[model samples]
Target: MDLILDFFLVSGIVIIAIILLQLFKVKHKELPQKVLIVLFLLLFFVAIHFYALLHNIIWLIHLCFLPNDITTTILGPLLFLYVKTLFLKEDGLVKNTLGHFIPAFLFALGITIPTMLFNIFKIDTLAYTHTNFIRTIIRFESLYFTLYLFISLQLLSRYRKLSKQKYSNLTQYDFNWIKIMFLSALFIMSIDIGIKLYESFWGDLSWNADYISVLCMIVLVSFLGYYGVNQSKVLLPSFLLNKEKALNIEKTKDKTLSPNKKEEFETLKHKLEQVLHTDRPYLDEDLTLGKLAQQVSTKDKILSTLLNQYLNTTFYDLINKYRVDAVKEKINLDSYKNYSLFGIACECGFKSRTSFNRIFKKHTGFSPSEFKNNTL
Candidate 1:
């Protein structure tokens, strides 16, 4: 038994040590608050469970006095925080102050109060004495565990809802690893709580071993490093949202168009250039393939094909290139020098200062004002 406990115990500690080292690697990167929270929960679990391993070594008893309820109480809420941190937009609902921690605080207090009270009065019964206070604590443990389950369910449902809606602006979030970590922890905690509840009712400690809990703790601690090592944090840009991207390759793909359709496409493309040079497409943020296709008397598929093959860019980029060109021309004009660069971009059909600046910088490597100043 000691040999088994020692093997699992050392393995758990080594895994956590690796995770701690991995955190330093991504210290410069943007870590969402929920990821940070998961990191701390893992650290806490390791610290307590490591002590359990120490106690097992010294006392020749597995699981020592370090109860499973400590980590079992925390797994769900930490996962709930993870969901909020990943997919939420600006100033989301999860951004409350310390009040949000009341549930966790109360649970921690439940554990501390019992142990502290036991120590203060030398009430050996929580360990040796079978008392009402211990029973009450177990009951509250079940209630909080249930609350955590419900919260996790809500987070999962909300994640599905937001993902299905396909919000174009916030597609950058990819919490796939964190999602797996949360689910795994949730599974372990559910079983841990079930055991606690059964023990509280029947006074049987079936399947409650310190070694098993310690093994799971090691796996949970690896969550921080696992995602960082395997994945990238590059966010999805606004232009790529819900839009099919053109494949990049040396060989041109077969267009599958007939002789009559080919002539019609060339004619329409020429007319589109003429109309766009006259009126411009950059002025409208909602300018899409369908809209462009209609103005030129062609279908969306034909226009999309042209944009994909000839331009070697998405429809969004193709339009933005023209917008940038127009912005530069306006900036060069001496008459427009009297107005702000933003005003110049507005006249060139840019809807917002931010869009104008972003698209211009993407192409020109300079902001609108910066480019204007340099040209002037």
Candidate 2:
């Protein structure tokens, strides 16, 4: 058990070190960097909590004893915000959404004020006058974190469905890693809740339980690092909103296309295809609905509506379709016979090999290598 605890402590330090390197060593500070900083700070507190639990070092225990265990309070909001940053256009915190951190702030104040008066200032004889109150808050905070975990899952599910509706291939903007992390988090939190229940009902717990919690935390950190580092950026044009607000948008958009405008829409759809073929805008790789609209001298909303209603596809899908066709043409060209399949894909405006391969397989029945071999 001692060995396990020691290993877990070392693992926490290693994870923290890796996070620090990522934060400072990277040249550009992007959304992912900002997300990592949040994760790092969260784990830093957890590590301190673990050290305090071990009680080997007197000063460490003193430092942690009165400090608010606000880890749970902040973790949920941070994670949910991280997911928001990944997919939403306005990734930063908004005025209305700032209330999410209110509970965390309240917890910090609740813990610190009483502890300062009782422990540090010695104004009260008791070391912790609000022991029962603090314990109750901690219990409720566990449940609160669980609620946020569910909220995060819902947000991810919503975004994923919306992504499919907006994009043909998910490889470029997939958040599968984040999904895995959230599920792992749910499992970890369940274990924590169970332990907390045991402590509440079954009296004192063994050191082994502490060891297990620390080990689980270590696993959580590993998940964060692995997923957070490799995640690709996602560009969602829609405004970020809460679940209720997002549902309202869906309801409003449910109104079908007017029959009177169907003929004009078909004409515009035909024009869209002609423009796409002649301009070959998909070859630019960064082609977006607005950019394509500008190229075709069309309004963004008009193009969005045309793609969604008339073509039964998204701008992303329609663009990728053209890109796939272009790649097929390039692959068959005599001048490109010597080019590697990936090179051809890149030339055809596919940025990621994973995306290219996945989308190619989706469009064609065979893989790139299979197609190349069959041609031979």
Candidate 3:
């Protein structure tokens, strides 16, 4: 048991060090900046948690600085915001999002005010944890953690739905690993709740369950660190590009298309199709609406509008339609006849067999192998 505690403590410090190193050295700006903030907060929280469990060390730190449990209040908001910032185009700390961090602010105040008074009067902090105020704060933090975790799950679900609606190659953006991380959090929370309830009813268990919880948290933080560092940066959906412009265009479309504007739209449509045919950008699995717009020499809004309003499809469908056609064309050729269906899919810019099979079937109303066999 002591060995397990030592393992968690060592692991927590090591992970925090690695996270700090990555934050300083990595220079790419493809992902949102807020992601690093969330990762840092999570790693810091876990490290502090394990630090507090070590005997003598915890007392020394507590004696110097007030013990804080604000990390509990902040973790949920950080996770929810991380998902939002990753998927959305705008920076996450807009006025609308200010409310998300209110709990953290409140918890910090709860801790700081009391600790300041204690320090001012030179009062001992030994019995602070037993106070009703502290107990109430702890309860609220636990309740809020559960609530915020569910909200994070909802954010992930919403991101998934939007991604499927707008992007073809979801391998990078799916964030399935995040779902696993959330479930792990919930598991830890359940164990924590159970431990608290047992302590309340019976008494403290002989084995220190809080240490076990901290160990679980260290593992969870390790997973969070791994995923945060490796996860691919997200591309904003095309429809979300210049949202004000989209809204204005949507409102006016109900009235009429002016002659010049209609002509421009036609030109844009021709250019879009020409680029799709000539350049074959869909063969690049990481192709995005913005990238396609650049290739076609059109604005993202105009290109997305062309696909959404004119063609009545999404960027995902339009691109995957091309990919599906490319695969069909390849499968029909004598050169690809001996190749595996998955190999043909990979050659045709399908990132995974699952996405390829799904998209291919959606477009042609038949699986790749079925289509090939029927044609043969």
Clashing residue pairs, candidate 1? 125-129
Tens-place lDDT per residue, model 2, 1-376, is 6676777787787887787677777787677567677667667766776766675675565565543266778788878887877777554544445789898888777675566456556765455546776676677777898899999999898887666444544665768877887888788788888988888887767554655655777787877776676577676555323443223333233365566677777777787778888987778876666777787677766776666555666666778878888888788788998899999988888888888888888888889888877867
Better TM-score candidate (2, 3)? 2
lDDT of 1 by residue, 147-246 (tens): 6656766665555433322221122234555557656756766766777667668886644344455567577666655664434333222222323432
User: What is the C-alpha local distance difference test score of each model?
Assistant: 0.57, 0.72, 0.71
Q: How accurate is candidate 2 locally (lDDT)?
A: 0.72
RMSD of each: 15.5, 4.2, 4.8
Which stretches of model 1 miss by more than 4 angstroms? Answer: 29-70, 89-97, 120-130, 139-143, 160-174, 206-210, 228-376
Question: Using lDDT as the measure, what is the rank order of every candidate, best first?
Answer: 2, 3, 1
Q: Which candidate is the best by TM-score?
A: 2
Collision count of model 1: 1
lDDT over C-alpha atoms for residue 335 of model 1: 83
Off by over 4 Å in 2: 21-35, 65-68, 89-94, 111-137, 160-174, 208-210, 222-235, 238-255, 329-336, 369-376
Q: What TM-score does each of the candidates earn?
A: 0.49, 0.79, 0.74
After superposing candidate 3, which stretches have Cα over 4 Å from the reference? 27-42, 48-52, 56-68, 89-96, 112-129, 163-167, 197-208, 235-281, 284-286, 291-299, 306-312, 361-376
